[model samples]
Target: MCRQIHPNLAKDSVGLGGRSKETINRKWDELAICLNTHESGATKNGQCWRRVSLCYILLFILLSSLIDNFYNCAESYFSL
Candidate 1:
């Protein structure tokens, strides 16, 4: 679902952004139709996609594999 909307980011395309809003809207509409056709049970309303941004949230994470040992470093670095 997401990959369809942001194909360049998902696949690492290096293109600059100048595409019109209508193009993005059409992509969302097409994706909604495709998902509906597959019986995936996701929302068929393309507008629903605008309400959530899983990709943007994922971009905020930087800890990854270092989280388990985070406290070990923090113990000596902080007064907590």
Candidate 2:
């Protein structure tokens, strides 16, 4: 006679598999974007682009502020 598995196990297994697939799919998309694949068709790609752009802009602003501060200090020291 064949024994039946618990119903809860089946449900949990299905949920686990779905989560794994979603994680793998996200990784693949990131790799594709790294390779410069077509990102226009994907909703996730739009969010990725926005996040990347925001990060770059913030970095640029940070570096510019540091440079300005350095220049101001140099000018002040030379004027003294």
Candidate 3:
């Protein structure tokens, strides 16, 4: 996810080239704080949720494929 540029900082040159070092450093500090907060909340329960969801999706795919193969084999056997 991308952060929106602060209005005051947006008009300046990219990379904060035209701004004072203090202002640029302050912006970087703000960005770091935002990232830390976002990650902390996400990590609290996100890991387990992601793992469970991924496993379920993969299991569903595998089961569907197996069912399709079984149906094909049954169809051929019956047609013979």
Best by TM-score: 2
Tens digit of per-residue lDDT, candidate 1, span 1-80? 53454664233333435655556666667666666676556664655654444445465455654674697789868966
RMSD of 3: 12.6
Q: Estimate the TM-score of every prediction.
A: 0.45, 0.47, 0.45
By summed lDDT, the worst window of 10 consecutive residues in model 1 runs over: 8-17
lDDT of 2 by residue, 1-80 (tens): 01323343212233456585555445444544553554555444534654665688789999999999999999999999
Provide the lDDT at 55 for model 2: 80
Model 3: number of clashes?
0
lDDT of the candidates, in the order given: 0.56, 0.56, 0.59
TM-score of 1: 0.45
Model 2 lDDT, residue 75, Cα: 100
Candidate number that wins on lDDT, 1 or 2: 1
